[model samples]
Target: MSTPDQPAAFKPPANDPWKGFRGVCSGTLILESIVVFLAIPAIAKLGEGVGAGAVVYLVVLGVVMILACGVQSRPWAMGLNLGLQVALIAGWFVHPAVGAMGLLFAAVWVYMLYLRKDIQARIERGLLPGQRD
Candidate 1:
């Protein structure tokens, strides 16, 4: 309630929630890249000796994941991330451990997407803290 001469207090607009989400996605990619790199030693020793081509493939995929981190804000970034997951799973040809790692990360991505949808629904309902009157 305000008097005729008194103005209502000012409230700043809500922050862009997706900004933090992008950071999380970037960090996850970096972690995934490290894991992919670490799998190299296992690939060489545990399996029937990894081929030079297979090693090169893993290295390139890891590097691509790191590079993808820089573009997390783009609209197509999610598509690229999902594509990489598929590539990792396809690593079945190279080694089963690599494929298992991909499956684990894919589950993580599914959960992240579910959280994204929940946030969007909250925003639409004006249920976020900043949206309150």
Candidate 2:
């Protein structure tokens, strides 16, 4: 306990939950961005006027999420995703079939967010690699 010139003892983590969840969420965002981007042209051709705007917005938002949060404390990412979900579901009232597919995407996004929240909490509590922000 007396350590004027000595450093404290180092203790490694029992496990790193943050890294695993980070990988999953980051990968999911990348994949979802790709899918949405690719589908944009087709959707536009199908006469969905908002397709381009939606694709651009999603791609930009996903990149920003990765940069700002990197799947760690990704509050922006999760919130934006949930917002999209609500939008998609509301869209169902206008176009049932199309919105149904959107709902599936929304469901997947929500699941990913659910999986990442635990990691975010850990990070916030100073249980992960970095210090609290």
Candidate 3:
């Protein structure tokens, strides 16, 4: 029996696939935000001659990373995350450690994107036998 307040069946969340790849990406972004912020004081201590602008840039980047993570489920968010990766790589000039972090995150980002595509393909081709279409 069905009622106006209840459907005849239940539906799972469609947007997240491949065991919550989007969730993984979102978590990675939040973690990156924290790492970026933690590097701020080190940037100041480097004393190879840094300006307030450097700190400001890192702060703004950290904030953007956190905010963007919240919207990772949106299609455009993939691009935003990639852009942040590039920025992180560019931050290498500030310190080699930032570049290393960027490389690691970039690798994870690529893996997530690849997984998403694979999952979508399986869903479309009806090959994912254990799951609903």
Candidate 4:
């Protein structure tokens, strides 16, 4: 059913769990930071329905994301990103106005995960200009 020239799919071990988690974490930090920068202030001024606590949460999460994104390794990023995503998702239930931002964050996180297959290759061979991985 398969040809010799075809390469097998690269799958991280199920037991490792953390690999996927780290990828999500890394993506979360990057995306969440952007959302917070744009959404929180907008909601504060435009909506006026979202409370100060929600704004405070976004600011704090932004700070944590800044620290988490500084890590160079992918696995580390994944863990942090997972925690961050969980926090954002949880926030959605507590604050629907803020929760809307998670959709954007989730979209970016999924997109980043889709490109994760090249992580090792990029670390070894280097990324070309405008390359996705």
Candidate 5:
């Protein structure tokens, strides 16, 4: 519907940006937080010296994720999210298993971001359902 200079008659998402990406990431974070909460006791048993700190860290991370998801329109939110995912990898200090899980989620984050890009490109090309090519 559009060339290089203008919008098509089939206008697309104009008001919200990155909505799909934000939603996916936010949902993932919610589940991650739940996992962290459930794993607290196990982590506490494994990292005797760092258990309390780990608990606090996990709680704070969840809070930050909530805030980031709430304000995903801000560019910094995604950066903060990625930064936290990297930080989660540091859970290896507490337990190798948790660290391994963190790495898995980190990969998920990466895949989702790439998926988002592909989705956006499809929308732009009118390749999505209900879109005109």
Candidate 6:
């Protein structure tokens, strides 16, 4: 279908995209956990003052995020990840900064989901180079 003046679209070698996807998800969770941990100082200094409850909540949530990374390959993992996002957004009650961070990361996750869908579509359509030959 390509004209002499026009090159065909590039198709990467077919491979297990989900492997890299899991890695990306894990990395994102780790980074989000770091950001959540970093928000502790802000919460302590700026908000109603870091009470024991706030500290515990943030620390626990960060730990949960880290732990969630380990289960990224599970069927329930996406639901769990989405649930964590809701929990993070709920942190607004603790501090607006925490909620804002949640919103930011939520956007990132949404984009990731969109890309996942696209990849799945490509696989189904045999668009990958490995699929071609």
Top TM-score: which candidate number?
A: 1
Report clash pairs, candidate 6.
none
Per-model TM-score on C-alpha atoms: 0.87, 0.49, 0.74, 0.58, 0.76, 0.86
Please give, for residues 30-50, the per-residue lDDT of candidate 4 as tens digits.
666877767666776654456
Give the candidates in order of lDDT, highest first. Answer: 1, 6, 3, 5, 4, 2
List, residue by residue over 20-45, the lDDT tens digit for candidate 2: 66576666656655654554454556
Residue pairs with colliding backbones in model 1 are none
What local distance difference test score does each model get?
Answer: 0.88, 0.57, 0.79, 0.63, 0.73, 0.87
What are the per-model numbers of colliding residue pairs?
A: 0, 0, 0, 7, 0, 0
Evaluate residue 47 in candidate 3 and report its C-alpha lDDT on the 0 to 100 scale: 56
**Local distance difference test, candidate 5:** 0.73
Candidate 3: tens digits of C-alpha lDDT, residues 1-133: 5589964453343544544777788888989899999888776676575567767778898999999977876779899999999999888886787788889989988987888788777766545555454
Model 4 residue-pair collision total: 7
Model 3 score (lDDT): 0.79
Model 2 alpha-carbon drift over 4 Å, by segment: 1-13, 47-71, 74-77, 84-101, 113-133
What ranking emerges by TM-score with the best candidate at the front? 1, 6, 5, 3, 4, 2
Q: Residue 121 deviation, candidate 3, in Å?
A: 1.9
What lDDT, from 0 to 1, does candidate 4 have? 0.63
TM-score of 4: 0.58
Q: Taking the tens digit of each residue's C-alpha lDDT, what string does model 5 give over 35-70?
A: 766667766666453466777877776677666667
lDDT of predicted model 2: 0.57
Off by over 4 Å in 1: 1-13
Residue-level lDDT tens digits of model 6 in 19-73: 8888999999999999999999977888467778878989999999999999999
Write down the TM-score for model 2.
0.49
Query: Which candidate would rank higher by lDDT, 4 or 6?
Result: 6
